[model samples]
Target: MTSENTIKNQLPDAISARVRSAKLSEGVATLVMDATGLARPQAEALEADLRGALEGAEGVSEVRVAMMADKVKRPIIAVGSGKGGVGKSTLTANLAVSLARAGYKVGVVDADIYGPSQPTLLDPSGQKPKARDKQLIAVDSEFGVKLLSTGHMIEPGKAIAWRGPMTGGALTQMMEADWGDTELLLIDLPPGTGDIQLTMIQKFKPDGAVVVSTPQDLSLIDAARAMDLFRQAHVPIIGLVENMAGYMCPHCGEISDPFGTGGAQAAAGQLEETFLGRIPLAMEIRVSSDTGQPLAAGDTPQGQAFAGIARKVSDWLKAKGSHG
Candidate 1:
């Protein structure tokens, strides 16, 4: 007769390494296997291998396997800008979608407490998050990204009017929410260096930051300030993104630089930071965002721009050995 000890000892090396706990009783063998850092297919394969190894064991008439994945500390990336309206939220939304499309489990926290917009941009269904055991569950969006935002907690068009501590508490709640199997979190920070930014730096401590700006001098100056804050905190500046770099006329197909071109790249060069890529000011992008459909969900030209940026970010993560 096969005892629990006998079954565990007989497990193949590969299967033994992943089996966390096992039991055998009344001709039934049950197993709990660790599936950490494994994709769905890999986890499934592991289960299959384990069942094959034990199904024919003496005194085992049935096999039950439960694949359990240990919670991992996912890397958090902050996406911030010097001021509002430079398309920081838009970039964050598309970047999350782009990363998800590239086979990553991504989540977004709309940390712009006073002006949360991720729920609007990623999930137009206006669904509120369900809570379990006092922890907030992240809302699922059709774009394959998870989201949590104050917008989901409040009525539409309601002013937040929160003080510094209140806003910090709100950020904390979202940051510590239940984000199962999320490999990366892109935090859409409120613009400028303020209470919320300071709280995030001192508390959550993001792994890196992506500063956004237009190609204009004013936006670049503010962007530099934002970068300086991250530098002071010793958080790596992943790179800079130039949003609204140029616009193409729908009528004549003429390319124009309304915010002035190449300024962000030049600024990056001078500051010794990487200029990840640029996103043009396209009408399609605006329309898609307004309609709660991320341009990066498709393969349009605008979508391709976001995809290119995501690739660069992924490369940076891989180089740093931070990508799992």
Candidate 2:
């Protein structure tokens, strides 16, 4: 067979799918890829295909595949849990606010497909997100971080009873929403390592994950399970956060450990993960979040704690660089 025919015969399936036509001259193979609506990942896949196939083809010294597409994939970090009421959503909201304060264009996706609470925490006014061509436009929040959530799409305080496919679809819509220049995305995943978590790990693919749990043995066990899911999926663990670590009495100067202290940190150590920090069980944090005013939006102690966590996450992202 001729060199050109041999090269065409050995083209990869990815190249065959995209190439509308192909030509060869000398030792170089040229391909006109029909990449009309491809995202960045698709274009990258095409590039990989050409590099792998044509580079090894007999007599082909170079390959050129021109692609046309209009999209980029941004970094996504997931804040998740193994069970409910671990304060993951609150932490996600405050972390977003803190990261925004630190000058990173951050966005939050409430992947809590069943128990989404980010709308209540970040955009409590009940403003629904707009859509264009079926892609959601993240709702603007008073906290400066854009948000897309099932909570935003549904009525307030109602439970979501969606099954697998429906939940997966909603999470995908939020995860793939138009986040504009948001450099960092925090997805507040639903409690437990279930379908939503699996979908995110397989589909959305967060750059890193911060697992949240209370300072208790049971909660720590569950948190570890969630962490294992991310680990198995090859997603980096940014850190483990011990929530409700200690509570200080309002009227007096007494510190209380209602959920027991240091459990999450010790778990992190055993798991060989970074301990991000602790967030005290504070009435101020609850009140602020309920009022659509994240404590991180202020300069209070509660705010400072979340700021510290955000800084650690930011440092992780910086260290991880463009890959994260």
Candidate 3:
């Protein structure tokens, strides 16, 4: 008595929506399975489950599952800073590399129209992205990460003094790239809440945002404003990261806190937000990052710091259970 409709109703609730069509003929069951947004392992498991369920049904001798994945909507995570000097862009680069190293398919969009520094950090050679079918192509980096930045299209050291519409258009072009298999797209937003930020919220609608700030009251105040922007737009605030919390002198072995640490954590506590972690003010980190070599791509102390932060962010998003 088992038929196509019966088998579909018996399919797991997880992939029920993916059942495009099903048919049964001569004791052979055929199913059209949509695996969009599913990871490779997940797709494989789904196929097995479908086959088992169909074969176990009455009158079903063989089962065939044709798996297909439609174009998936990549989740966006916007990383913003209160002010420009809090090393937000640098953190974005390292975080992307860390996530990629952890086997996550990740890409970055340098959405900082005013000051696009990601090209220097990710692609020092100033490589330009090629276009096909009127869509931009993402440049592959050495750390197994993909990147699209306004810096790659503009001249170095030149200011991008454009109006709101121009800036929004550029951001659109960078985002419309061929980011194949990229599950997570990290947008390195420009400093503060402005037209660019508003455009992103209104158009792209990010899944969440991570605010970066230094361990100082001034920067923390700005960071609070940035978080409020995302909150107003109904975007979830993933957490806050305190950068430049401490600095150690390699020559004299002296530790210093010139920026007066813990301000960002205290701010997060007051706002009842999750305080992700901190990054130290290390000279090696600066040198390595500025030279197109992200510390998070290597096995060093600074790299571990960035990796730790990446894991927390990644886990936080995964807990939401929306993405595969």
Task: State the lDDT of candidate 3 residue by residue for 1-324, as single tens digits.
Answer: 446676678777766678887888888888899988675567888898787766767877888889988888788999998798999999999999999988888899999988888989999877899887898988888878899988898777788789889999999988877776678899999998998899999999999999999998999999999999999999999999999989998899888999998899999999999998999999988998789999998899889999999988889878987444
lDDT at residue 138 of model 3 (Cα atoms): 87
Model 3 residue 68 CA deviation (Å) reads 8.8
Candidate 2 Cα outliers beyond 4 Å, as residue runs = 1-70
Give candidate 1's root-mean-square deviation (CA, Å).
4.1
* lDDT tens digits by residue: candidate 1, 3-56: 656778878888898888888888889888999977556888889888888888
Question: What is the lDDT for 25 in model 1?
Answer: 87
The most accurate candidate by lDDT is 1
Over 4 Å off, model 1: 1-4, 7-18, 21-71
lDDT of 3: 0.88
Task: Return whichever of 1 and 3 wins on lDDT.
Answer: 1
RMSD of each: 4.1, 9.5, 6.3
Predicted model with the maximum TM-score? 1
TM-score of 2: 0.78
Q: What lDDT score is found at residue 71 in candidate 3?
A: 80
TM of each candidate vs. truth? 0.85, 0.78, 0.80
